[model samples]
Target chain A: MARAGLNAERLTRAGADLADELGFDQVTLSALASRFEVRVASLYSHVRGSADLRARIALFALAELADRAADALAGRSGKDALAALANVYRDYARTHPGRYAATQLRLDPETAAASAGPRHAQLTRAILRGYDLTGTDQTHAVRLLGSVFHGYVSLELGGGFDHSAPDTEETWSRILDALDSLLRNWPD
Target chain B: MARAGLNAERLTRAGADLADELGFDQVTLSALASRFEVRVASLYSHVRGSADLRARIALFALAELADRAADALAGRSGKDALAALANVYRDYARTHPGRYAATQLRLDPETAAASAGPRHAQLTRAILRGYDLTGTDQTHAVRLLGSVFHGYVSLELGGGFDHSAPDTEETWSRILDALDSLLRNWPD
Candidate 1:
């Protein structure tokens, strides 16, 4: 029989926690099973295998990130909203490095389409609405924002900014300020 | 005697190739040994273990990327120089995803300081000179540029832009143009 309370959601949550603790790439069915004090075969009832576990973690992270972004951006606009949304990502990555890493895993198109990724793109567009861009320019702006947030956070977390001067926190605030200025006066 | 052709450099190169063929996370000493038609013990003569091999790949990638960026920036400045430098990174990442991923790996402080990463920072600073930034703002600009380049390329490689409209290429060029404009008129 299955473990008394085991199910996909429970297993997924545990997997995310494990990922946060052990690093995403280190997550495996065997590790989860060991953590749960169950045999590896028991995990098959909850997840197909390593790939499925990773996909679940990815989905979990995307949804969590989107929800946090939506919360932060609920009543804000312009640079206010932009900073709010950006912090949601950077803060989450700091607090949950492994889960944050999981979000970067490449999902198949079908799976990606069904995940909260669309919400992320939409949220980005919503923020850009205050910037007065339209058509392809707006799309380009959305991508720029995405790249900045993802790239800055990734580099920061990877110690790219650790050995530098002026402190990363100061630089982050300044970068955001610069981005706000860039978006406000976006070139035609 | 050791294999006639095997050494740290040779093994590191082969490891990078293995990383490209498989994935960075999948590159292993055993796998390298298997590919070379040699025993696992024989491989130890060169690399201490998986960690050492990965570190070598990271160093190799940093140096290689630095060399390319230096070449691209040799006779350029301002927006022209920025475009050249950015293209070098985006193109290198596209052609060498695995090696590019390895570049993102966090090296120990001593190793990172010794690697060609300093050259990358110098090159970035050189690009900023044409923008008229100085002191902290120049540092901030460098960080911003790093984030955007790293962030955009990473998202592109991870297929984040695959299902989007206007095509990634359009957004890329527009982003560069926007960056050029932003740098030219950076807020005080």
Candidate 2:
């Protein structure tokens, strides 16, 4: 019989916690079952399988990150908003490395379309409003910002900046200043 | 007796091929042994364990990528060199997704110091020579370029750019142009 108190929400929360404790890639249905002290079969009632569990976790992470981004971006504009948004991502990654990694999971087309990804894109466009870009230029700028934020954070978390001169914080601030300047004076 | 044809180099090469076929995270000592039709114990003579195998693969990928970058940068300067370097990374990632992913693995400080990572830094600085940046600003520029190239390629591979209009290629070319322009006019 299915566990009386277990449900997908609770199970997924536990799974996310497990991911945080272990690594995201270490998450599996078998491990979650062990954590719950239930048979692996019991999990099937809540989560379809490993793939379903991962997809749920990915959705949860996207929603959570999107919420944080939206909150950080509130009541801010221009460079302030840009910095706030960028820090939100970096801070979240540092605090919740597993969940942040989950946010990078490649979902199927259907799941991706239904994900909070569009909200992220909209947020990026909102930041671009402070600058004068329009049309294709705006789209290109969005990709650039996404690349920088994602790349820098991934590299930092991977220890790329460790044992190097000039602390990462200084480099981060300088990069932001350069990005803001570049956006302000975007080429024609 | 140890397999006559089996050695650490051959095993590492086979492991790299396995990584390319089944993804790096899936490569294991047991799998390689099975591939060789040898007992797992017999393979230990050739590879210390899975960790050693992964480290070797990472080192191999780094050297290969650095070599490609060196070749691409030869006889090129300015934006041409930048574009060539960026394309090398992108193309390599597209052609060898597993090896490219391995290049992102976190090696110990000692292992990293001995890897071709410093060669990559030198090449990045070489490209920066075309710009007027020096000292810390040059370091910041190197980080920025690394972030963009790594981030954009990671996102593109993760299907973040799929189903979008204006095409990813357009964005890539425009991003390079913007980067070149930004480097030319870096703020004081």
Candidate closest to the true structure, highest DockQ: 1
Report, in order, each candidate's fnat: 0.92, 0.85
Each model's DockQ score: 0.90, 0.86
Model 1, stretches more than 4 Å misplaced? B1-4
Q: How does model 2 score on DockQ? A: 0.86
User: Residue pairs in steric clash, candidate 2?
Assistant: none
Model 2: runs farther than 4 Å from truth?
A: A1-4, B1-4
Write model 1 residue lDDT over B11-126, tens digit each, in one string.
89988988888888889888888888888888888888889999999999999999999999998999999999999999999988889999998899999999998889889999
Q: lDDT by residue for model 2 over B19-136, one digit each (tens)?
A: 8888888888888888988888877787788888899999999999999999999999999999999999999888888888889888999999899988887898899999999889
Look at candidate 1 and tell me the lDDT of residue A143.
94
Q: What TM-score, to 2 decimal places, does chain A of model 2 have?
A: 0.96
For residue B77, model 2's alpha carbon misses the true position, in angstroms, by: 1.6
Please state the error at residue B122 of candidate 2 in Å.
1.9
Clashing pairs in 1: none
